[model samples]
Target: MRTTHPHPTNAVEPPIAGTAEARRVSPNAGWWRVIGTVLGIMLLLVAYYWVHKPLDLSLVLRLGGLLLDLAVNIALFVAGGALGRALLASLNWAVVSRGERIAFEALAGLGVISTGALLAGMAGLFRGVFLWLIVAVAFLIAMRRGGGSWLVDARAFTRALRPIDRWARLWGIVACALLAMALARALAPPFAWDALNYHLVGPARYLSEGRIVPAPDNFYLGFPQLLELLFGVAMSAFGRDTVAAPLHFGFGVLGLILVAGLVRRHTDVRAGWLAVALPLSATSFWLLFGWPYVDLAVFAYGAAVLVAAVNWREHRETGWLVVAGVALGFGAGTKYTAGLLAIGLAAMIVVEARSRALRPLLLAGGVA
Candidate 1:
């Protein structure tokens, strides 16, 4: 005779006490509390501002314009990311991790956009219409080339993510706050010395003259101007220098993402958060956090080079080497000091690929 079962075949087991699942609060109450606290603080800040100085129509109108400009700068970045995704897809690369894919696409896309702008500026196509046309064309091409599929993949990845532990959430909040402060500074008018001297000056002059003209007085203009070219794109498209700081801030954000990504790939999630926190907390990093300077761009592309190089080492994929080379090229373009990165990367390749290393080094070098 068959015996009756104590529980159904699909019966759920209660979480064991002291285990992670058991420790999790029901309905994510912790998140609600965090959200409430943030909202309360925001409301208080607004009330204080209102009490100190009444909001005027002119102030509201000015804020609206700033918002509009910010939106335009972000839209340009999104277009570049889409275009970069298309370019990567064309390469037939098959990155499995969503984080990796996002990082690579953003870096590659921005590099492509910046490089195109540089070429266009050199060819005297730095006018508003041409800059806007480049952005439009990139957007159209990205849409044509599997943009929908990429979006679906991204959505699925986010939906499938596991709930973060409390420590992770705390660190995440810190990171966000830091980046938010940097962004607030970026949205303000740029006053950084280097920015006024050559960074913005070069872009302003280029926009006025409608090309990349020689600047004999400003020797800094002679440096590889990959970052300045991006500034020109923003200034030309939006008619404001404020957008340029945010654009540079974007590279700083990318640097954070890359630091986290590289660490997470090699180690674990906890380590990744630590990596992000460590650099972001540095006084040196904060010094240029939202400045319209090329330092962040150099940091970003240099990080990309390492990410691609490490990925190539692990997976032995030829495409990753090309990616590394491209990143190095962009990094070098952003600042000549990236030649130092190239040296470090070359040594790394040789040390890691001890046997038959010539081909790999040659490939990355040729691409760079």
Candidate 2:
């Protein structure tokens, strides 16, 4: 009765101190978010201006050709990837994620396409029209052989993607910046030291001769030229040496993709992004993307071998072993240094064999 004199015992209390102020902070937080977004946009604009000052008519004209060259270059890769898919359709890919499988297909396709180009160049069939016809044939074969399934699978994978966490976001940003810079550098005229000395020189000579000829004076020509022949294909298709730079960039980008996929297969998605950023963070590797060099090709083919070998180890399927062997062969064909990878991979196969079996060793050694 005494408590009820002023108010009921169970009555609601008054609002707590500072409650209104805390409620007001939500709108302020939203305003800050808006400000941050606007500032980020402005920063990006400033960076663009800093990089490309006084963009002139001549620059604009060159941009059109650049776009065309890039388109043709990408088209060739896509066609090659389709052919690769067709070639690998029989393999059991249950061990890998779809993204990883696509990467494998792309790497394989590049090997196949380059090998075809090398053969064509050897036969004096490296003309622009013939290259275009080869691209057409690859596309036709792919469409006839269940090509739509890959597109569907890719779409499913895209739909399944969710926003990455903070760490992955950071790494993704760095990877994108490095890739963009590499592309810009590739667009510039060829002035890299090694590129001028032999990389571009060999392909230029091969294209001019209309066949693969022995270049005794340039000792580098005697080395494996798997990637150089692809450069020749690009140059012949586009009628410019500049096209090869972008092609090199493409190889580097694919190498990063293979790396990311392999890491994701072994660990988690975030680690995959980290793997991509880590390799690209190196100045030399990033710069190699802009030069008409085979380093990136070796990196890509080597990654392919690793991924295929891992798949084989998990599934114990000879097809995956064959895939790994093919990748190793292509890598060795790109550069002599890649033979080191073959040695390492051969040892790995021997160590992994059942009771140290001789069959696996023989198959791997012969393939390598």
Candidate 3:
């Protein structure tokens, strides 16, 4: 029976259903991916155009002075910080560290610049870059000529970021991308109504006439001018409000850093990064960061206040308290809303130091 059987050569075979479906869908999937990528690119281009608007070659060309002014400001900030560090250490100013000293110097820079701008505006002195240069040079020359380095800790901090966990690295990239995008938006014409009305106008007016004049037209001009003073200096140098945007972005970054540092005290690095990501990743952050709004300024100073509080608690150092006070003052000065933040932090401080006598409360209340 087996020998008599012969198979039909034309017999049909069963179809490979998976292979058929896959073959049919594979080309469609490839097309879809291509379409999705193109759509994404187009959306990105459109967003950039909308946020950054018409590209101005003139503004691009004029950015050089802004860069120079920012550099000078940073240098001035470091030198002033170094000098403050030396003075505080020599005077036994509560055992401050280089990092704390740097923070102090930044606080000092803000106060000094704003005060100088106001005083000079009153005295008819703030006309050009010469005044800032003179002050910066004085600090640089008076930096004590040796011993502790102002930027050493900062460099070490940056280096330390290299070995962080994968989550931290991922969030860091996201944070940086957000910051860059916000900065890009900032480089364009300020679409923010408040900024166009007063923030930029106030600085522009101050820089133009070498004085901080009253703006009855817009209420924001009467608001805290601390943030604008830095911008005013740049405006004075460049004769425009071109440099203010990036300055705000920098403040946003500072806020994120301070928040992450504060959170890192009790948790893993990922938690700290998540804390950093929360604010920076929000759309509101970009809107505020790209404009001349003081919300970001509030964030920066508020975080500093909290971090300094924790630092004082950990180290029992009076310098940190002083730093916290200074930062809180600036935060309050930046916006009226900062009052709520101040009250909340005060409550936290009270709860945390309930065991201590009225001394801690007195110190905090008095300094604040």
Candidate 4:
């Protein structure tokens, strides 16, 4: 009774409040950044040599053009990325926090833009090594920043690639078959009369212009600029006659790769293989793959949308939903048929979100 109660001397200090310390870059990250910076400089030099030597533009104009090209490319990438992100937000399928999603979208946009520019340059829109350098730098930066793993899970990728793994083996077979078909087409002349009439023709026109413009005379034919624009880049590099067929073949391969990846994500190896094979066997697929029509691009984007939808459904990630919407938008832009898929997907999203009382579903739908 004489001693006062001991003062609470050991009360735990409240843990530091607010946000945690910013994540430190890993040693691996620093190493990658160093490598990227070096590679970027080298590529820039290569670009200088290629653009200035043969093109013979006045020094002032060349500098101006380079700046202009970079500006335009960056703008396009940003716009596409924003549109894609907005679409994902609407669908209630985003995986990361908003801040992380923004970063990821920016990276993805850069990747797509670089891809477009590289393709355009390769097609001969500009005889500059600088464009390639820009693309290389952008791509390297994306990979180093962990953007390369954005769309699909890399951890699962190796397992997906395993030969003994049923899914991997199936995908492998599908890949081989697709390759053989492409080889066959390449060895022969390009098919699908429509390709020659519209797809290749539009790109050839764009390459000649060194810019893009709507071909009003071909009004009945819709032109989605992304792939054609890339084709134009190639034509600039290789000359139209030499590049057109091969470029189409290349795009076809890319489409197949996208499809295979989507299928792999959605189902097991066997199902993925079947999804790929079904498209391969379809007459339309053969026509699209063998010819230079934009259908393959449409298919690729459409499949991407479907895959994004599935991702949204499974994970409740708004980013995925937004991506699906963007993919759908691009698919619709590429071809009218994709609209049906987009409509169906939108309906499903609404129903699912309504059932779950998720706010993101409403947000995603509005964006889409």
Each model's lDDT comes to: 0.80, 0.79, 0.65, 0.54
Q: If the candidates were sorted by their lDDT against the true structure, best first, what order would they fall in? A: 1, 2, 3, 4
Instruction: Give the Cα RMSD of candidate 4.
Output: 24.2
Give model 4's TM-score versus the native structure.
Answer: 0.56
Model 4, stretches more than 4 Å misplaced?
Answer: 1-111, 114-137, 140-175, 187-191, 220-222, 241-267, 355-362, 365-368
Between which residue pairs do clashes occur in model 2? Answer: none
Order by TM-score, highest first: 1, 2, 3, 4
Q: Worst 10-residue stretch by lDDT in candidate 4? A: 17-26
**96, model 2: CA deviation in Å?**
1.3
lDDT tens per residue, model 4, 1-368: 57765666666544443323212423365577789999999999889977767545576664554344434333333343453343233444233323234333533353365356646544554433444444455555555555444333322433444455666577667656775776456434445577667767776665565545557789644544555554454445435333444445544544454555555555555665565566677666665555655666666666566666767788877667766666666566566777788567867777777766456555555544
TM-score for each predicted model, relative to the true structure: 0.81, 0.80, 0.72, 0.56
Tell me the deviation in Å of residue 275 in model 1: 1.5
lDDT of 2 by residue, 1-368 (tens): 33435877688776554577654645476677789999999999999988887688898878877886798777767776677788899999787777777667777777777777777778987776665677677778886897546656656765764437988888888888898998988977789887888888888887777778898898978889888877777887767778888888887777777788888878887898899889888888888988878898888888888888887777888888888888888889999888788777777787788576577767766776
lDDT of 3 by residue, 106-160 (tens): 5545545555666776676667664566456546654655313656755665566
Top candidate (TM-score):
1
Q: State each model's C-alpha RMSD to the native.
A: 16.9, 11.7, 8.9, 24.2
Off by over 4 Å in 2: 1-57, 148-163, 354-356
With candidate 2 superimposed using the best TM-score fit, by how many Å does residue 44's alpha carbon deviate from the native?
25
